[model samples]
Target chain A: MKLLSGEIISNEKCGKGLYKIEVFSPYICRNANAGQFVNVKCSPDGILDPLLRRPFSIYNVEKEYNVFSILYLEKGKGTKFLSDLKKGSNLNFAGPLGSSISIGDRSKNFLLVGGGIGIAPLYFLARTLIQKGKNIFFAAGFKDNNFIEWSGELTRLGINYRIFTEDGSWGDEGLATDFVKENIKKYKNYKIYCCGPRDMLISMQDILAGKKISVTALLEERMACGVGVCRGCAVKIKDGNGSFVYKTVCKDGPAFDLMEVIFD
Target chain B: MIEGSGINLSVNLGRIKLKNPVVTCSGTFSSGLEYSEFYDVSILGAVTTKSFSFVSRAGNPPPRIWETTCGMLNSIGLQNEGIDFFIKNHLPKIKSLGAKIILSIFGDDPGEFKKIAREVKKVESSLLAVELNLSCPNVKEGGIAFSSMPAEVEKITEAVCKILEIPLIVKLSPNSDSIIESAIRAKCGGAEAVSIINSIVGTAIDIDTFKPRLGNVTGGMSGPAIKPIALAKVYFLAKADILPIIGMGGIYDWRDAVEFLVAGASAVGVGTANFVDYEAGKKIIEGIRNYLSKKGINDINKIIGKAIC
Candidate 1:
């Protein structure tokens, strides 16, 4: 991975408390994949406030223009500083980090599940899968109607998708877990790829347990060095012998088999 | 005119000699597992592994780290697969890289420290030195308490030093009552060198949640914010002439490393800076060589205490 300076091409408010920032970095955009992320240095030089770089999933990549975008919410100090960045400012970023989601056997049906902002990476994955001429089923859940901004893009891509909202003011009412529990058995041979809050992932895992389906989750944790040197962002994984070993989310995965995760 | 190629960056820490003075701090470099993928691990002075105990530690839960202004607070609780795993799985790989290895050992008491040190000595070969980490502020039992007391520091250092054939480097804590006194005690206990200023104890709170930001409630703070405090400590230790100080705190680049060397450090450790820039060690090495050549200083040893009057 290379540490390159990215100039902001545009930063726009895409949804409620969500932003889509596109940056110009040929080095990162050329090598970036679907599930990989970028560690963005939000603060300016000589400013130590908000000292760590925030890791964001690669939302989209336009290799022709050498531009990549990241979808983020105003969660804390780092993103709050990032939200204030303008069109012409320079941002130092290190990336194409973390392991990418493995697409095994393109002939099988690909079922993608995402919750809230976790859909950022899944959008990239769906685009790649569609281009590969694979059968894709996408389902996303948001808190309310204000978060359904990506539906338009999904439609333009001619992707068959379902949207759910907790407030019942949007599409289907209830969690994404409810959607999976209702229609998961319809596909014969499939692999489930999911990303979202831990609660949502766990709920879906509970419904899929003891089944023949294979599920890979794009996990999330508070990370410092996205390069795996700092030993931050560790997640416990159960080995084959029913014991748990600590694997870092930055290196060993931002993706892991759902069966291996020992979510405490 | 021997301007670029004649610059020598080698350094001597007690009986141990290093190719350069840039070392990765303990608990940051991950025993050369992750960093070797980015750059050659042997380019630095030495690679200090993360602190390991006798038994495996699960460490703290999620939210173990929090970002502050110019620094970070972490209570990782010394997570490791224990000394046994390091010897079996990690040592051969680290040894193969041909980098000087300084094994950092931590424990809950003097006896535990001696036990782990003895075990490490028996299995590992080509070890440059053993760093006894007496100043980890995250754990409650054997960390800050031992380093805070001069008598306990002397006891632990002497206990660990008696068992090993290699030189012992005692890592000091900044939160102690008197850092210089602690260093002097380590020297009396036969420590070859001292690594100053392990992360200082600090805390942060979430304004909206009205609760602690870190899962451990408190953690040791490191980065640029702590550089000034670390520099002063290294200066005082060097002024006292207690022992050769391996100074570190908020070292980001070559200028920061040079500041530590001039403040009386025989070597410098790069910790939190690795999180910011993964290739910081390589960049700093080049920066130091360029600075030395430009200043017409042939040997790095001449600049060890150049700033001290």
Candidate 2:
């Protein structure tokens, strides 16, 4: 079903240069999955730069009143325009699209690694797994401690959470991949999930190359159509012919098994 | 006060009623259908499907798009699931949308359009219209972009019009020197409507990298920059008899829609604007409504071709 256009019920600056815009999209809030996303059209009048829709991972969805939230860093014109939206402003978007994470196949003991805004989907994944009695360990990487937004929930749920900042002002100094590599031995039988920059995922893949750890990595790439028709978001995959064929990131997955995809 | 603010604007495309005109350009929002759940689909005037072909196309490799100052360049290579798969999986779902569905169909030759259109006509209840993407640059045929010549455009338009009983919208290419001639041929071939212009042929160079921005080396450009050219082509096409005009090119708001209407379009297709604002269509509707009210006009049709006069 098509999601209804949302009104910006509120906008507030949560941290330095980062803002949270709450939209009342009942349809989306109710149907959006943890790993899904929404394509937001930033300029209502079309005078802005980058005249194309921007896709963001579902940060959170409140099904009760049908409210959805996106936490973003005001990086480009699109984000800047979104940040400027006031209460009662209307924003058009479409979503809860893309391949969702199937929690049914995951192990009871789970480890989630996120970097920057990649933490968006991790929050929802951790919450769902925790509800099912999955032992959750979430480690995040950011430029600074100000980027951490899940402290209270992590504490309340009794989920073991760690933070790594690039400047070493947070829990650790290096990338989140190192922590996964160093700690993989301790959680040998656990399922590993990660979302972050390409380098981080690639580095993690190298560390677990010979290990017995199962990994599901979320990738970010350029996509033209959210559906498989565009072929703009094709990622290399094993075809029936035993050769690597192109499958859509939006359809085949934003999340794929480590063995199924080939990284640059 | 801005025009779109405080306006309850929405529209219906086929069966789906969008909250507005602002929508992601086809091939720009590749999160898949799932993303529609988190965002507002009702805010768009319509959701145009990505260009599809007779068979599944792998499209071009990575670096398919590059962001320019006011627009984006893309050479997606017209990747698709083929018409058969689209009907099997996508058709059933599109029928359920609250907004209108515009199918963008691309083919290598005239026969492909007719074949796809025939199949699509079977599920016409799910769609508002079929957009002929005969204009996309040919990936396999040394980039001999279709819709550039009048003969090819006429051939495809006539072929699809023969098979499909529903509205046939031919999307025209801006790369051609004589856009009106192509429009005339399409109209003569029985196009129910004509949409122009589909991205200008362009290329972007990376200064430091010393290479073209797109993987295909060349791409079609869309955004505000192309608005003038699109408007001119649309105006020329509107001069012809029969069928309606769906004008598009960097349309961001109500004023843009008005321009298209004056230039001889019945309805406007908003593409590039979706990237800037998802609610652009809604806002544009509101803006147009207010403009109409202020001008003491009850029906929008009165303004059609007014600019040409």
Candidate 3:
């Protein structure tokens, strides 16, 4: 991946607390895939407190305009700087850097599960799957109604959607796991795709075990080189000899068979 | 006479031929993959990859790194995809970047080192050299710091040398009390080159919370603060003339790169500075060129060992 000087084409609040930043980086946009991320060099000289680059998944690619949009939560310094960016600010970024989810046989029904910010990537995947004429089933978990901004996007795409919250303020009062267990037969013919906190993915893997479901999960790990050069993103897998083996998330995957990963 | 033209900035480390004396230290900036989209990887003398191990590691939990003045401390936990996966997947990608790939290997035991080295050597076409990480104390066994014990260092390096035909750079740990002895042991163990002063063992505590700043509790300190110590080691080790020294510590600019050269190093490695700016290597290269032009140096070879009295 190459680092490009991206001008902020647009920064708008898409829904709720999330902001959509459309950065115009011709170099990155040309090579950027759906699930990969860019390490944004936030400030010009560098940022204070949080000095390292922030990682963001590529939200969407506007090829004709040579721009790629990143959706992020403005919680820390890196995102804070990113949010306050003027219209023409330039960001030093590297990208098309991680593994994307595998989209196979569009004719089969697909079940997607995403938790909190994890929904960012599933949105991209959802768009891709819909383009291929797949019947999509979605289960999204958020804290409350304030985080349900993505509902409109799903409705627009004509996707079958369900929302779960820890509190009963919106959707169901239980977790996504509850919703899946309650509605397993509905997704029996579909492949399951998941992205979220580690526990959520692990839970999904457990509930779907021994079923006809094929599960692929997107994992998040702290990374140094979005490329495979740094092993910082390695995840443990079960070895053939009933031992443990390691795989890199950046190259080998951000996507892997749910059964292959040995989650802690 | 041109101001900097007379200086020779070229040095040979084992089989790898570098255009200049500056190199990037491992675990910093990483290879072309990090900024491959924005920066030119070929402009640097060479790229040292982050340390890798035999197993895939998630590394230490978040809050893995902290930035200090002019440098940083990281407890990356020796995270890496196992050697098998690296050779199968990453080698071709790294080779495509055109920079000399210095494979950094770390493990818990000498046998693991041999395994990684053997597999890496099997794909010698993609790698220029193998750098054994012996300094990290985070792992339960086989840290690069194994060289702290002269005999063990010799034994480990020897074992690695036996399996690989490519040049071997024994990355020395600064945690040792006597770095010279470690260097000597590495050479005796069949190492063709040595990289001095992997981050010194250091710690950072938050004032408000009064606790360790990194998730790993302690970390290897890198950047300008460790340069003097690194320079001293390079200076003394280069005296042996048995192996080339890849000197690095706190090297943020070309002038700093030149210091390692003047201190008797054939090449230098850039760390910490790589994170501060994406074009750090190119800027340093330009600065070195300007220094050479000012000194009236045409061939970089003359600069090696120029500091000798």
User: Predictions ranked by DockQ, top down?
Assistant: 1, 2, 3
Overall local distance difference test of candidate 3:
0.74
Off by over 4 Å in 1: A6-12, A23-31, A62-67, A80-91, A147-149, A187-189, A209-212, A239-243, B1-5, B293-299, B306-309
lDDT of 1 by residue, B112-186 (tens): 988898798796466888898999999988899977788888998898877888888999999977788888889
Identify the superior model by DockQ, candidate 1 or candidate 3: 1
True contacts kept of each: 0.61, 0.40, 0.27
Write the residue-wise lDDT of candidate 1 on A7-75 in tens digits. Answer: 899998878778999999898767887889998887776466777788999998888899999989988
DockQ of 2: 0.25
All models, DockQ values?
Answer: 0.60, 0.25, 0.19
For model 3, state the Cα shift of residue A250 in Å.
1.9
Candidate with top lDDT is: 1
DockQ, model 3, C-alpha based:
0.19
Q: Specify the highest-TM-score model's number.
A: 1
Which of the CAPRI classes, incorrect, acceptable, medium or high, describes model 2? acceptable
In terms of lDDT, which candidate is stronger, 1 or 2? Answer: 1
Q: By TM-score, how accurate is candidate 1?
A: 0.90
Please give, for residues B1-309, the per-residue lDDT of candidate 2 as tens digits: 224444433432232333443333454332225435435454455667777787888777667767777777777787767888878887666555565667878877777777778788788877766778767653654123566577787788888877777667777777768577777787788776667777887888989989887778988888787889889887877776445666888786788888988898767776655445534555676788788778876556677779885
Candidate 1 chain B: 10-residue stretch with minimal lDDT? B1-10
